[model samples]
Target: MRLSAKRHFGIALVVAGALMCLAGAALYVMPGPGFPVLALGLAAVVIGLLLLAALRRE
Candidate 1:
């Protein structure tokens, strides 16, 4: 079945968030400040999950 556009966007956000988290980890290993990126990634993941959940209810 074809997924809705909103669902696709949500999934993209989750994937992007995961990548951001990985980048943040690399930054930490390189002696840079990574907390902000990590926090933003976590937030994006949470928002994406919430969006998915909300769409599922419809």
Candidate 2:
């Protein structure tokens, strides 16, 4: 099946968010600020999920 651009973008957001969360976790173990990154990542993931769900419903 072929995926549309919107789907690709949504997937990209999810993946990028996951990577950001991972980086944030790693930072938390080190000596940097991690909360902001983690929050942004969570937001990105949520937005992506919502977008995907909305698209699926259409």
Candidate 3:
């Protein structure tokens, strides 16, 4: 099946967000702006998922 560019972008965002969240989780134990990273990751994930949802509706 062919995927639309919008869908591809949404998937990329989801993947990047997931990776960021993973990195943040790792940083949490290392001590160094952990909270900020975690927050940013969470925000990215939320935005990405929202984008995905929007794209799916289209």
Query: Which of the numbered candidates is closest to the native, going by highest lDDT?
Result: 2
lDDT of 2 by residue, 1-58 (tens): 3458889889999999999999888888889999899888888999999888978997
lDDT of each: 0.87, 0.88, 0.78
Q: Encode model 3's per-residue lDDT on 1-58: one tens digit a residue.
A: 3458777777787788788888888888887767777788788778878988887886
Predictions ranked by lDDT, top down? 2, 1, 3
The pairs that clash in candidate 2 are none
lDDT of 1 by residue, 6-42 (tens): 9999998999898888888788788899878888888
TM-score of each: 0.86, 0.89, 0.79
Per-residue error (Å), model 2, residue 34: 0.9
How many steric overlaps are in each model, in order? 0, 0, 0
TM-score ranking from best candidate downward: 2, 1, 3
Those runs of model 3 whose alpha carbons end farther than 4 Å from true positions after fitting are 1-3
Return the clash pairs for model 1, or none.
none
